[model samples]
Target: MDFIPEALNKKPEVLLIYTQRMIRGRTFEMIENLGILTLAAQLNANGFEAKAYTGITTDAVKTIKNMKDRLFAVCFYCDFDNQSAVAAIISYLKKHYHFYVVLGGPQTLHMTEKDLGSFQADGILKGEGEETLLTWLNAKIRGEAVLVPGEIQPAQNADYIYLEDFSKYALPRNEDVLDYHERPLLSVITARGCPYRCAFCFEGGNSKNLRMRTAKDVLDEIEARLKRSQRPRYLFFCDDTFTTNPVRLRKILSGVKRLREKYDFVWFCEGHPGFLVKHLEFIREMIDSGMVRMQIGMESGVDDVLKAYGKQASPEDIKKVVEICYAAGLPQLTGNYIIGGAFETAETLATTTRKALELLDLAPGMLDLSTTFIMPLPGTQIYNQPEKFGIVLEDRECLTNLEDFPVNHTKELSLPEVCMGRSRFITAVSNKMKEQYEHGLITKERIQADFKLAFNYGIAAGYLKFIYGKNNLMVEYYKKLIDYQGLLKEWHELSEQEKNTWVIQRIPDFSLFDINTLSQLEIDILAGAGSDTIGETAEKLSLSAEKIGVLLKGLSDRYFVLFSPFI
Candidate 1:
């Protein structure tokens, strides 16, 4: 997203806000504003100061107000989930704060002139922004004509700029702006762009060009990430297709193997089935390089659906990739499956579900999956030309829905039918994945590792919902929610006065129940909670332990209080 003005103050500091949209019940999977962090690192390298914040627009407005006049231009990584909030933030900041507002991210790749005006942002940066943002801002700082990266002409209509040499900027992941000591989003972007244009992927707008950082640079980053932390770290390769280039991949694996000898860490990456199959020899090397897990884009197990979606891999490739990873002794291999896509039929959906379960059965403990309803995000092939994919869009507004539901239906499947099919598919897969633990397939150590990983930065991963189903780490927590031997203590952050006067209605949403509010009794119980076990606290309150045990469990789940047996 980009249009830069040729005038601005040279006061070095910039603010990049990643506006979050909350859907009452569900939270985002992302623990941090990764894109904003990448841009912040870029600015730091260019002799400018920047900080990244992820919050609702209201919280963002307060952050800007706190900065007062230091903010000459505030940038945002605007996205589909919160467009209205971003637009409102831009309009208000421009009106009252009186600073230049720049927007970028997935939404900008598809925004038009009218959309830009409505957003009230000075410019929308399209495609990659690491280089463009710096170029545009630097030119404005020097009072030179602002332009796109590598372009001789002034920036015009929606532009797509790739950082040509991805190594031109700093490591895309930055920990300076992040205070997270445990999980600093140890994600690395060894490369950018995908060569394949899958019909539903936003990468289609990325211009189908692949640019890679040098192997030494990527290796240096992995070592840098592992150097300071003593605990086991999980690094995620954020590249869409980490296995795209085989020779480079081999070098990466070799570097990671060397690093593992000195650092306690494991890593995961998104893999392309087609590439993995072609370079099948690398699977063992990847696992040997501390690669414990892999995420695959097995959109469907039906070849017809895969073909219609323009995915390069066939169902055979998906099966082969899973078997290769599992047989190579890869501990875990999870793939993504689309339930309600353009060409989905009952038979195709069943094929995906049945075959997916069969794959899991084949590997038993090693294979798993996540299923999502197909939503045509803007700029994707289906969004641009639904007719081409034989999809009919019905509820356009559902595009921003945090919960997955069918928004479009094919000629063969009605909206309701698609919805039902998706529900069935998810239920079946989630159940099978659960058995990975219940039947002693997936281990408690892994589930615990994943659990800690989800909240490493103090926010739940979207997969928290699934964590409960796997039912491993929580067993002890549940057993001790009111364990008479354990004590109940308020989260240190809650003030004494808050406990004294706050009513049940005054409490904010709980992790357990944004839907269920605290009852008056629950409030009293919270106020009285302390180092004393609930059995003792109940006696003090003249209430039965069971009466308030469940309530305290809810409060404890939200971290309102730490009901021991948990950290």
Candidate 2:
């Protein structure tokens, strides 16, 4: 009656290594290395003693050293940013241990044998690794020769293996490998591969086919996970496009609604604007089914830019979808934007900024915006044929380094120009929000939440600037905000006109200045600065002399304004 295989206890062990990477200063998504955990689960099910080390503790080397004799294979779930770490680990294993080393994941797909040689790994698993890994391990266990697609050695059996039905594989359990006992969020994948061809996306562009699990299968997995975690805080659907198939999505929502009645949990998923608009009722159903948030990839707000990037929806489509979601009473909506893409010009960037502002205006307190420069990942059209997009690739090694913006030059803009443009766009959005706050359009609580979101963007843009060899003005501004909290509080207490003069005199760079600091009255005051006296300047601008005198005194103290001593 025992489920454990007798052979597994006797077989040599396998070690799966997963290193963490940060995205947008958030590690919530990376907490569980799902791919490796799924591989380990399959290995265990197939009568192999597999253990995983998720870099939670620095015991990988000690574990490997202790089990050197029993360790048969060392598998690494590689990431673009962790190439050096992977190489270091592989080199150490090769130098001391004799186990077969296997490299897999998106990073392996783009690397050549020469590029991989330094790591001294025995083989690499290209494409989906589940079936290939299970097949190779089974062959190895059976004392038969195995061949990997990109390896130097060839086996007698060279056929590739892929799981036709995704449901056959067991759902990954995060508690098995990840330190998820205390974590509130758990990520689950309902599907594999994306059908769309996004030029800036390596994953979607390289996805040969779309494969999905049935609603029953997904719901069963969710129910099991909830039972294990005792209903975790949130369930994140990590599918590339959760609503790509409306029929399947509706079925899934119905099952989720049934589950929600029994469990106290909320869920989040990613969706496209086209699908969101097409399936309005489904979105409402999802919200009713405890779907708290949906992240939409509205890549750009310019129609031409979206078309050039092969996006399915236009700016109008995105706005309409946002309006629909608002009408549907969705709790929170997050929109992702890519700034520098093919055919992007100053006018297009402005149009995009304006459109993004319009979206913000639509959902003043509900919308969360994330903006970034387009990265040309390997295997994408932009990467394979850079000349077509007028892109000049720089630092191929850094393609996977998403923390800092990757280096590339478009025909229309250089890397620095792109970085600056991205910063300006984010600043513009922040200013608009600030303006709303100043005019009493939005609550202080809303402004504070908006500031937090804008701060994250500032940190990202500042890192990008540092990468692009520009002064990290955004970073400095962030420091100023933290260091000058008292000064800012005092500045906020000043009348709207005084605050404007303070900002204009202190922060001369318009791009860096918060536009909300400048009111129409302040603009008029500046326009009438050539008058002989404060009274005349105030009269000219239709403002009181007392107000002008206060602004003039503040500016003079900062050496920004001067008065005629003879007068």
Candidate 3:
């Protein structure tokens, strides 16, 4: 059952399951994912043979088997988008190979003890898996019993471990890292943790104290990546907050400005809206220096909800940041709003939605409304005071269902209402953003193709929803695809002559084929294989102007294989 060579017998073979979304259109592959890959490489370098499974590869079974029967299993349960898929895989793996499962990332780290029980995972790495996981793996390799941070109980006399520092590990190397295409954006982590204590966020609680690499460290990594490839289209800063410290961010930006003069590519990262406003000049400099997009977690429109979530900022802060971004000549700026919260009533939800729409009108930037369901995770105040907020964490399985349920409830809104309102808000905001992008309210100086891909997926999703009732498959089918920025490029780059319209025909090859409402003939016509005019399409579908309008709107939005209507 052992696969390691005799020379490496002392070193344990570890299987790190890196699950990714299956749908290609809906997912946006963030930079943080690279951290796990880097972690794997680090373990390999230390003598433990580590292999990663993205879960989308065709040979996933073989890949898992190659690493199976290893001394330990560390599953990097990173993205919450496909926890069910990961859960299924974990269940199957454990059933076959009784390996120790270690879970981390936003989803796993945030799991309620009950939810953790459901995951049936042996242990949970509470925060910052770098030091925690490395210590555990090292202990196991040496045949010392290992106990992870936050492990409730370990086998008798197990080796207990925790990381006192994160700086000891070098920034991960970017060479030979594969994306969906051979040329997917290079992801780099310059920093970790955020100063803000927003209640709605489960991701940033990993560290109370934020740490960042030196400007030289960041630039060195970028320079190494550039040496590997002449200028990949984008560099993603997967840090929780890249610009928390204006001076350091500016230093990185200044370094990038020099690089862009020669490389001429784009970069993006998340930020606090308040920070962006306070550092408007630096933001403008960053944009000019080729930082194309800045994402802000402006979680609520109502001032009360902002306070309730401990956001420590106002809607005015959101307004100021957006206005500054628009004025800074930044091509794209994205702001997030949480629809349901302690202060959110249906009426308040409406107010937040109204304020969001107004912000879009006033600021002239893209707007995105995040999931309303309040996700309660471990290490946060929300986990301990679930009763204070009417949130009960039933079990470890709750983490898998966070995207669907509100682990925490507010007096103002019921869970169902929050979910519904959130969906509606998402629809409204996406529609408004698409209109703004189409009307040229926001300029896309960088990653125009990526935006176009997102735009098309939105259109397709809208059309599908309009035609078929709003179903989970329809929603998940699109969300999964859009998140997979790397994988989409693989489907797209199959041939140079291949057009985007081919998705109408080719999408069936993937898992989403189950949700396709269009018949085989319709798919062929929609895919541009057969001659089907808009009128013919309308007639064949025999739907109302509303339905036809939805389809046309989606197609025009970038869903169809037709020319870019926005362009």
Candidate 4:
């Protein structure tokens, strides 16, 4: 809104609305809507005065009312959850405003003519919208007839926009939506489409061609981001498969490594198992270049389940990639699995659970796991023909809720059975973590960290109580985490030599001892007194030197603190 100039007599020609759904619980993690911004940039380049609204805010409505007769184009990029909001906005605009309403993005690809009629949109632009929208607008401006999808042209090939230089457009900043600590996390997209055609994925069916930006172009965008206000500390690459092309990946990593030295920041990305395994050396280079986390799509653990879903990787391939990432010093690796696919059965679910546990056992404290039920999104094979996969499509609305168990039931398994299988898998992984903690394979700190990660995801899915019992486990773990933080605070206040000693001794506990009751001399020694000798302190306190030495040794032994002469 601040970017729009009020002194101009003429009203803007276009208003782009980037609609986003209200994330039920995870409000702290909302990402900026970048698609609409890209469209705005394209329209501006073609001599159109285009302004963008992230959502249908009060300011947006006022701006539209003021320019009621002057506006020509109003475009909306909506997703599944936000379709209702977009419809309401479009209905209101049609009643009062004169501009043509255009609906685009993934949500529109599946909508039938009946659905489009409900919104009362003047035109429908499906698939990638930039080129279609621009061409339509140019024709309208020239007083020429403009044909849109659902009326004259097919939605699939409505002039998909693949920019040769993606960097020409300015990306979204969205600093207001971020939390205090999250201000530094910026999102950047290096590629447009995915190469793999996994049957369960909407991207595979929607993208006709895979395109990527040059590594130098991407690096230049990053450098520009660094110069902006509130400099970012992390870059989240929003690509579907960041490592799709190995040659480009290497050039990006090499450039990032050079830039990282000048501007200190880390990054997280999405990767595929096949690419990660084939390029271990590149993974290492990525780690060195501040790639701290990766989310890998290991859709299923059973080979049959994977093959049915058109996933090229096997269970063994997933395991190998996990092993390699852990060895490369990657701090966090998230293995994502989709249960209840076309070939999903009780047996396959069990195999998947076993594989998940095996991966957890492979790296006790490093790897993280996430499992979600498969949703038959529109344009995918499963959605078009449910009977071929032995599934019955009951309610299309259920597609909006992919985080939960599959709402539709397969011929081999009922709805209850599907829910049970998913619950069992989550419990099994959690129990395995508890078992490791009990056996001392992993510390309580590691268990707490893993649970925190799980809790965040559970909250997002609105299933925290269902997955982990009615807040009891969460409450108990939170108390333990608090206690650990208290101990860590005291540990951090110690001298460098004392801190080294604690690490060398595996972080011994001194919390049981009461510091308040100790004499001043005893407290000084414990606090690493600068120059006070044990003998002089003993003489000053009227205790024998032998007695003081024994006391010091006893304290060290009890706390597991090793005394190093080199310090």
Alpha-carbon local distance difference test for all models? 0.67, 0.65, 0.57, 0.64
lDDT of 3 by residue, 243-262 (tens): 78877887898898898777
Among these predictions, the greatest TM-score belongs to 1
Ranking by lDDT: 1, 2, 4, 3
Write the residue-wise lDDT of candidate 1 on 49-78 in tens digits. Answer: 777776766667788898746665688886
Q: Is candidate 1 or candidate 3 better by lDDT?
A: 1
Candidate that beats the other on lDDT, 1 or 4, i.e. the better one: 1
> What does candidate 4's lDDT look like per residue over 33-62, in tens digits?
567756776677667777666543444466
Question: Residue by residue across 1-567, what tens digits does model 2's lDDT show?
Answer: 111343345865778887644432245234466788788877787777676666622355666677676677888877665667778878887877667888876776666656456667877676567677777777766668765553433322222233458777767776556234545666788887789888888768776577888888899988888887753357779877788888888889888888878876777898888777766677778888877678888877778778877888888888887887777766468877776677666777788888889987886555667786656666788878877776677765573455457477667887778788888988887777556544556433333323332342221222122221133332343334434444532223446544334332232334644446656765555444434445556666776756765666554332233333122
Candidates 2 and 4: which is better by lDDT? 2
What is candidate 3's local distance difference test score?
A: 0.57
How many Å off is the CA of 498 in candidate 2? 42
> Which candidate would rank higher by lDDT, 3 or 4?
4
TM-score of each: 0.74, 0.71, 0.67, 0.72
Candidate 3 Cα outliers beyond 4 Å, as residue runs: 1-13, 20-32, 56-62, 66-91, 98-167, 174-181, 203-206, 363-372, 386-409, 430-567
Clashing pairs in 2: none
